[model samples]
Target: AGITGTILILGHTDPLFLRELLEYRITQTVIDKAHGIQLDAAAAQAGQIPEVHLKIDSGMHRLGIDTRQPEDAAAMFALENLNITGIYTHLAATDSIAGEDIAYTRRQIDAFNGLLRTLQGMNIQIPLTHMQNSYGLLNYPDVCCDSVRIGASLYGMGSKEPHKSNVIIDLRPVLSLRARIVMIRTLEKGECFGYGMMFRADRKSRIAILPLGYVEGLPRKLACGRGTALVHGRRVPFAGLVCMDQLALDVTDVPDAKPGDTVTLIGRDGEEEIGIVDVAEAAETLHVEILCRIGQRVATVVIDE
Candidate 1:
């Protein structure tokens, strides 16, 4: 990966962090809101200002200056020390293919363009401009200015349901999670399991205890037989509620399941595989949410193949 490009700091610039960025000659950054004069002062101290990209709130109503306010745009551009090299806006909802949401996204695009024209009217020439996130990159590719910020798509996830992107790139998942069975036990037909006695063995069943639980980022909904794990190339259901640091799976069907055996929470095991989308659907959430909420207690390993 021979890439040489500046990383965009998505949040408000802190003075201390700005100083370090300046020291490292990092030139690209997005100014989401007014950060007082400290930002300019820091850049001035470093002998040159960064190529600042002004973020306008086209309709997201989150972290950006209102595009309706021309004064805000002018004031930032007028800063003698900083160079307004780019202007960008975030899309609120680009996943809606039709109706009000799509119409609203169009309105935001119009507003963003208007803001660009307003800057141009004042003789301010921003060399680069972009307003697309992953959804916009897929749906509004023709509206691209200078560049598009593709976030989730880079990780092989789509913005909409059905898990297929409009973009032609053949995307593949880059991350997979796995865990090991730590213990195994047999439960009587009438025996209860987990907190609150939420689940009970319908018959004599074998349970495999895993070193992972909701606290380790697995959703509790996945417990109580709602989710399944791949053990010995077969799907096995959870025995009961997910605990804080551990969970139990009904491995009765797989007689080979043992303490040292590996369990695939989300990855390939033999001929079977569990994907992020499958886990997200089981948790009733988005894939990104599932990935983000993975607890810090779990270790991570990166693979290139």
Candidate 2:
């Protein structure tokens, strides 16, 4: 935990949160709204001017000062005691390769650059400027910047359909989700399993019970054979409805699977792998959401290889 690198908070800011940031040694944050500027000014009056990066709303319109209103940003920069170290904007549609999306991204870049030029003419020089997210960096590498914000791609979980992008990188996944098989049993033909008897075995089937379910962030949408996991180096389908704290896998094909064997839910196991993107698709969500929704009960083991 001895990380000496700069930590920047990207969420909305307030007076209380500003003080909390200082206590935690988080000195830099993104200022995206008029309220944020006011908070910084108030902090300055209190003799603690926090380092901030101004965010411009070129097209996303989610946060940041409006691109058309450069005067507001200029005024914020002119405020005394404020350490405005960087400026940035969010690219709205750099994830798509569609012609319309491409043009829209270009317009966003142009608008952001125009604002930078305007600031330059007014003798305002923000030391750093960036406008690229993961897809932005991949699709618009020509739009140079001081830093690129890589989120999903940092975990090698970029767009599942990489063909939609102009650039592709061979990034390896650094995270994995695994669980131990807690029980193994066989259901005779016509026997029902799980809540609501969602699965009625058509044949005598061997299933492995896992200590993971919807409560552990396994999407309920994956219930009833929609999702799979790797057991004994083979893909095994979800055998029944995913319960609150447990689920079963149809390991009839994986005859050697047993209790205590490691089940790969989102990682490589032997020659088989269950990627996060695959889970996302089967769960009808994004890989980002899959990663974020992992329950606190799951132990995170950090391995450096």
Candidate number achieving the greatest lDDT relative to the actual structure: 2
Root mean square deviation (Cα) for candidate 1: 3.0
True-structure lDDT of candidate 1: 0.79
Task: List per-candidate RMSD values in Å.
Answer: 3.0, 1.9
Task: Give per-residue CA lDDT, model 1, range 196-248, as digits (tens).
Answer: 98878889989999998888788988978888899989999987888889999
Per-residue lDDT for 114-211 in model 2, tens only? 99989888998867888888888888889979998899998887754656596767789988999999999899999999888999999999989999
Give the TM-score (vs. native) of candidate 1. Answer: 0.86
TM-score of each: 0.86, 0.93
Stretches of model 2 off by over 4 angstroms after superposition: 27-33, 159-162
